[model samples]
Structures are given as structure tokens and as C-alpha cells.
Target: MLLQLISHSLGWLSAQVSAKAQDALIAVLSSGPVPQHVAFILDGNRRYARSKNMQIKEGHTDGFYTLRKMLEVCIHMNVRCVTAYTFSIENFKRSPAEVDALMDLAEEKLLELCQKGDILDKYGIKLVVVGHRDMLPERVKAAAEKAEEMTKNNDRAIFNLCMPYTSRDEIATAVQSTIHERLDEDADDTVTADDIEAHLMTSLSGSPPLDILVRTSGVKRLSDYLLWQCSEDTQLQFSSTYWPEFGMWDFVPIILDYQRKVWSKA
Candidate 1:
């Protein structure tokens, strides 16, 4: 019911009458102290594929296109950093064929983002892969490395793709890095939480932690997402639509609603 209202309201917004492409939405987005870093839990690809009786790879393909669209929107909206959950550490525990297909998709998408990625390049998006890279296949690593290098000069936004990442693994890696940093510097036992955060490879070291986190598939749980960054004032919005079907419309209203809560809505 609520989504219907939002959909109807936005449906009437055509390009001719559209004021600044999302003037109202952008007004709301700008009103608030905007989210510097936002993360996404992209889920329900397999389920969506099954509902359509299509191959899982087909569903992943759709999801990939959705990601491309949203990244473009994020660039336009000026979201500083956006992270998408691509794969988990335990995903390897799935059936061999399914796991292999997922790996192939990841590898393919990595290559796409690297060599022929005009959209990302056009928007000055820097690609950063977050997760246990050591666990990834050599080919995937090469693709990710290539993307990072290809987009290194671009700085309009940070696109962090999480592959083989899990909250438990992130914590363990943080601990290991903290220990290594202190020992490497020959520092005594006076290391604090701030020191550990500084050693973190991603933007968790920023002054303001994650401001908004979006999880699709109507899933309420964070489920091992952003263990260190989501502190107080963190906003969470869930979309029942699968990640493949999610678009800026899904995100725009939610941010507008949130903006109303944090600041005056336009």
C-alpha cells in the first residue's frame, strides 16, 4: 500500500515535467546531512530466477544490469561511496555447478567493469573490491586488479564490490591486521580501537560511519553486513523487490522519507 502510493506519485513524473530529473527527490536528498557511504545487500537472485524458471546465471545477469543502473544513479546523485554485497565466504559451500557459475559471473562482471566500463569511467567511479582476495581465483583477482588500475584516477565516487566477504571474516582480518600493524611498528600494547580502524582497508576509518544501509528482498537482517561501520544514527531500509528489479525509484523514496526524518523535506 505504501509502495503503491510512492510508485504512483513517481510514475507521473515524466522528463518533460521533471524538474531537475528528481528535483523533489534531490531536494530531499540535499536537505539532509547526506549519507557519505551507503552499502547494499543484494539478495534474491536465485529465488527470482526460480520464480521465472530461468537459469541462475540469467538472474545474475539481470542483477548485474541493475547494479550498473544504480551505480550510474549513485554517481548522478553524488553519493560518495556505495558498496554492493556480491558474494560471501560460505557461498563456496553451495552446489559445485552453482558455485562455478557464480564464479564465472563474478569474473565476467569484473572484466566488464575494468576494460569496457565507460559508464564507471564517465562518472569518475573508482572500483574497489572488498573481501578476502586471497580466497578468490587468480582470474578474478586479475580482473579486480585491472579494474582498480583502470579506474584509479577517477574519484567522483567509490564503488566497493564485496566478494567472498563475511562479517566474521572481516573481524578476523581486522584483528590480524591490527596485530600485524602494531608488531610491524614494534609498538607496545597501547593500541586502541581507533588504531584498529586506521588499519582497516576501507572507509570505516571515516569520521562518520555508514549513514544509510539498504538491504533488498525484504530481508530484515543485516546478515554479516558492515560489522564495524553501522553505529548509532545508521538508517536501514528494506525493499521487497529483488536486487535485480531494484532501481533508483526504490532508493529515491526511501532516501526522501529518511531525509524528512533527519531534516525538512522539500
Candidate 2:
């Protein structure tokens, strides 16, 4: 009982310190060039699980929790749009068991997104799952659709879940959609860059292109996420920490660095 009490007290104290630090950081950096849209390439779940000798599901669960925390932080920081690479189309190549687990997690998370106290309604954040719905499991796809419907009227912030998504696939689909729409209208057959952008799956947010794209776990490459949406001016920040270990406090420093370094240059 005494040990538990001590642990609880310490946790409370830590949270207090964290809260104060976060507020200070925000006060200083909020007036700076905050990202209008931020996207995350969440990596290192499996590696983290392996390192800890824990079940892969646990790592992914932690990653999801991190994502929730991230959204709250971004909203507080006044970021307009947030996109996450939840499940890539290429993830289908993983072991059947792992893929099944991911699908189950997605279905569960989507349901959670609609519940009270989950922040969707609290913050008026709209949720959109952009991907190939036909390729997803029925239950998962249904949950995503329901979540989108529930939050369709929200306008405060846009949250995009890139499930079963790939930049290459999205680009190709945009091209096809643009062409088909042009044909249906009996208009010009030429497909311009604007035409493709108009039909992009992720562009539903109607926000500016990504101003900041972060890939955690030390990976430098985009791994096929937001390939076209990240403009040349977008600041790409790579973190050494795993997604599960990333927090709003950790993110503040990166953004501050970007302001001092990248934004100044631009």
C-alpha cells in the first residue's frame, strides 16, 4: 500500500511538471510558424515490442495511445490538420496474424473515436479514413465509415487516418478518378496537376499541404506516406524515439528547432 501510494504521488508530480513545461513551451512557440497540417509516419512498433519482449499488440496499443495524446497536443497548439499513416497498403504483406491484429485494433479504435470524452466532439475534430475501402475488412471499413459520418459536421480540426493507404496507390486512384470524372462530364481529356489534386483521397481535408511531416524511430525515408502532399517547403523531422515513447513535450523541441532552422531559411 505504501509503495503504491508513493508511485501515485510521483506520477502526479511528474504530470504537474510536464503540464507546466508544456504550457511554457506553447506560450513561447505558439506565435511562431506552427504547422497548418502535420502528418506522422508512425514506425518502430514491432521493434519496440521485440526490445521489450512484449506482445506485438502491446506496442501497437501504446502507439495508438500516443496518437491520441498527439491529437490533443496538436489541437492545443492550433494545428488545423493531422494525418497519420495508421496502416499502409503494403502492411497486407505481413503475417496473417499480425495483419488480423491490426484490423481488429482499427475497428476498436474507430468505435472509440465516436464515444464521449474521446475528444472528437469535445474539440469538434472531423475524422476521415482515407484508403481503399474495398481492400479492408468489412467490420473495419464499416467502423471507419461510421466514424466519418458521426464527425462529418465537425470543422475545428481535420483528422485523417491513412488505413490501408499508400502514396503511390492514392496518386494512381486520383488520376483515375480525375479522368473518369472528366469523361463523365464530356469535358477535356487532359489531366492536369490540379485535376489530380482535386480528386486526391487525402485532400478531403481541404487544408494546405503538410507543413510538417514527422517520422519517428529514426527512419529518414517517408516509406510511401504523403509522398505528393508534402511540398518541398514542408519540414521533415525525424525522431530517434519510438512512437510509443513520443509525447507532446518531446515534439515541442522539434518544432522549436524547425522554427529556428527550417522556417527561418524558408
Candidate no. 2 TM-score: 0.94
Clashing pairs in 2: none
- After superposition, candidate 2 runs with Cα above 4 Å error: 261-266
- How many steric overlaps does candidate 1 have? 0
TM-score per prediction, in order, is: 0.85, 0.94
lDDT on C-alpha atoms for all candidate structures: 0.79, 0.88
Candidate no. 1 TM-score = 0.85
Candidate 2 lowest-lDDT run of ten: 202-211
Worst 10 residues of 1 by lDDT: 199-208
How do the residues 52-86 of candidate 1 rate in per-residue lDDT, one tens digit apiece? 99999899889989988877666666678888888
Model 1 misplacement above 4 A: 1-33, 204-208, 264-266
lDDT comparing candidate 2 with the true structure: 0.88
lDDT of 2 by residue, 162-259 (tens): 98899999999999888889889999888889889878887765766788899999989998888888857688889999999898767987788777
